[model samples]
Target: MTDSAAEARPPSIDSSRPHPARRYNYWLGGKDHFAADRESGDQIAAVMPSIRTAALANRAFLGRAARHIALQGVRQFLDIGTGIPAPGNTHEIVQAVDPRARIVYVDNDPLVLTHARALMSGTPGTITYLDADLRDPAAILDHKDLHALLDLTEPVGLLLVAVLHFVRDDEDPDGVVATLLDRLPAGSWVAASHATWEHTPAEVVAELQKSNRDGRFVPRDGDRFRALFDSRVQIAEPGVVSVADWHNDDPGRAPAADVMCNALVGRKR
Candidate 1:
């Protein structure tokens, strides 16, 4: 890692407590998680058996959205709440479309920061990582590394896949997204997905919501999820739908009820 990246590293990682990124990595069948993460993931999986499928579908949505945006001629991307290094990452997908494509990845997790080098291993100077939180859009937008790699004046792809639910309602998640979108120039696109309980059993939803009293995961319905984009963008064709169904033609795609995540791509007006 570079000096700046090392400086951004947290003092130490707390493996004793479960983190969203690590737990999600565990669910995605990655080996970068600890016992705490595994146990937490297992507990959730027991309740939501298709969570692993959901994770994979969400990952697929990210790649498809990145390619969709890149194909639209948007070469610059800002991906916040980036989880651990995974295949088909934003840089990899978009850079494949155009070698000159530039990307900035942001994540507050210390573990993700530790793997920043892997995430940024692409065309020289085409990708960078920031140790920042989505709740604090200014910190991410104002970061020198992000500005160095991405030009806000150009049409950029802003990715928020499967990350917004972690931000509680009290934190003003909509304002956070609106703030980020407000800074990007017109024609910029935002591809986002959020966990939902719309299709989940009422008893299960109640259990999940009660268990999440600490405000860790806040699942929204279709209408509430759609409201996050505000009036600054135009929802693309198909609007918000299951992550597995977005631009996916696989006959084996999991049902929306099983995936329980909604995804959408919108262009800033």
Candidate 2:
């Protein structure tokens, strides 16, 4: 709950075009999205109905990864491309495990920044939000707020969950990851999930590619997503599996392959 004065000056939102964060919120059954977002979500869902499931699974994976990272004694978190604040956010999960945990969430979307303050108001100084994009990891790393909240000398959880697909090939998403990790000490960890078109039918892939022509999404295969970690970071067990399968306590049930999203939590060596 931002103060009335802060709330009065909300960030500008372009509801005419569907934003990825809002569309993701809509898919996750959140109320922060506009009509355009819902329309875009519906269009994508109609082609690949499993996206809704992927969204939920991705959210759960974030919680699990955050908790696991906190349990590993890492108190600081940097979550980039954090979409519209929803239940089970990184701060909530990490703070639950370690009450003194610190978190910095970065997102370029103005609507996300507005809703972020409201959702994060309860946990004041422990959490901070930065209006930044993933394309320039260096800028985010050098930002005053991020520097103030996170100690690069110590271990920090670098969370890139379900946001990398938004970075197209020309952007060198792998280099972005490396650059960020290079700035952190050896103990820091990277937990990430990315959308993929590996197991889907050719027609399904075509439809998704056509819909994502705006370059908002660039779904990759498991190999490419995993390669982002490179030799600098080592992935943990159950390496690069679907979000539903990664550290899932549910045991017996496995989600359908076509709807799966690649997920992994790697530690810097």
Candidate 3:
């Protein structure tokens, strides 16, 4: 965990509470989760049986989007709300296309910072991790390490995968996204996937809403999800579809109705 001199002490991990990243890891069948995380995951799974499938599909979308952006000649990436190091990480996918690609992963989780070495290892490209929260976009953009590694004047691939739902409407999620995107140069790409209940059954949606009364998760509709990009970018083809169907050519892929997540990739104008 490389920390800037100005960085404060990393936040302590609260095993008692459920974190989005850990719960996500549990859904992805990873072992770096706590009992509270499993309990939250099981509760959600009980209502949405296809949640695990949605999680997998969202991860696949991240890979596809990263590779797609990299192939387009963007060599710098800023992946915010980065969960625990998983397979097909943004660095792994993009650096494969260009060894010199630079990546900065930002996450508030102290546990994710502990796994920073794993995320940086085995890749020739420049990779660094920052202990920051999505709610404070300025902290991420102002981090010395971020400026040290990435040339923000050049085109970048901004990744906000499966993490926006953790932010409630009152927190100004749209503003948070805008702040990050506004800092990037023109021609930069942004790929984001957010949880949604648009395609879900009413009964299941009601149950999900009740289960999420604690306000840990917020599922938006398609319109709300699409509005995250604002007028600064142009959404790519097959816009605002399920993560499973985003640029995926699998013959037997799950239907968009089955996956309760919306994904999109856009280029800055």
Candidate 4:
């Protein structure tokens, strides 16, 4: 294949084992998932039933948080671990408030890159797709494509939606978060949704651990999850509550802790 032909070809995705991005795509009912993702998702769901609700709530939190930031005059976004985009996407929510808002999506998933248009095709501002891993903050921070659409000097909304659990402790996730946050200027924002077993039943936690080893999502408990945020940022209201409870005005949803996922926002100082 010619170099140009290879560049035009869809990104190569590993279908042998379930990946977190693909499996998460499956949970969101998107079409980019593979059979391995489907099978692994079902297996995990069978063991831990709340996974579906957790996923939905996670997405809801992203929407609300994006709107919150956009209203605060944030016009640039660095959305990482941007799984197969489905609904209420970061750009969609942000652009509705300020059409000139720029968004840069970063993800290691080749499938997400292949299907990156879900986050692209904005009306006013620009959108760029980066085939990079969050594990390497240096690469993402210095990426040429992302820098074009985002201004490090200006406040940008850093979206860590449903990501971060993938960073094992040996990788120093806290340090990674700090590095990313430090690069952005003051008045920047960060919104994150993380998978946790804080209040999950002990039996469910055991099963989820097995699934994490076999599948994709890395489940953390409360303390470990919150440690990923840097101390420089001031946390937003509603604190580290579950996605369902973060700024919740509804009465029907389960209590935040009951869902076992924590969602929160912080502003750079």
Q: Lowest summed-lDDT stretch of 10 residues in model 1?
A: 1-10
| Model 3 lDDT tens row, 123-202 | 53498989999999999999999998999999999999998999999999989988998999999999999988888889
Q: Considering only N, C-alpha and C atoms within 3 Å, which residue pairs clash in candidate 3?
A: none
- Per-model lDDT: 0.88, 0.86, 0.87, 0.80
Worst 10 residues of 3 by lDDT: 1-10
Model 2 per-residue lDDT tens digits across residues 86-158:
8888988998888899999999889888877776688878889999999999999999988888889999899
Which order, best to worst by TM-score? 1, 2, 3, 4
- Candidate 4 has its poorest 10 consecutive residues by lDDT at 1-10
**What TM-score fits each model?**
0.94, 0.93, 0.93, 0.91
Candidate 2 local Cα displacement, residue 157, angstroms: 0.3
Instruction: Name the candidate, 2 or 4, with the larger lDDT value.
Output: 2
Alpha carbon lDDT of residue 183, candidate 3?
Answer: 92
Over 4 Å off in model 1, which ranges?
A: 1-11
The local lDDT score (0 to 100) that residue 129 gets in candidate 2 is 95
> How close is each model in CA RMSD to the real structure?
3.9, 3.3, 4.7, 4.1
